[model samples]
Target: MIAATRELPAAGYAPEVDGRLKAEFTTRLRQAGGEELKRRFPMLRIRIYDAQTHAREEI
Candidate 1:
């Protein structure tokens, strides 16, 4: 996902893209929850914050 994030030249991105990526990441994280990687991806909730505007979103 770093590659996709790097494609943008800013601190933020499109809400739709962010939403899609968040869903995909969350799914993959849950699917790969093996004993070896336990506690590695503790994503109980997903949130995105805009530091410039002080806005936050829970997805």
Candidate 2:
């Protein structure tokens, strides 16, 4: 599991926020493909956790 900690926006955890984050993660993963990501991280799961709300989202 890859846990990413982000400061909540003023508007908070909206659906769009999750979508944007997922897209950004995908882009970064692709950019870090092959040895860069696979050999180092080897993670296939992505998750977001909001400490304040105890909220979690699986991407």
lDDT of 2 by residue, 1-59 (tens): 98776444432332223233332222223333323433465564444434346465554
- Candidate 2: worst-modelled 10 consecutive residues by lDDT: 22-31
Question: Candidate 1 on 1-59: residue-level lDDT in tens?
Answer: 35544222134422222333332222223223332233454453444444345454554
**Candidate No. with top lDDT:** 2
Error of 2 at 19 (Å): 20
Query: Relative to the unseen true structure, what is the C-alpha lDDT of residue 20 in candidate 2, on a scale of 0 to 100?
Result: 38
Query: Which pairs of residues have clashing backbones in candidate 1?
Result: none
RMSD of each: 10.2, 10.3
TM of each candidate vs. truth: 0.27, 0.27
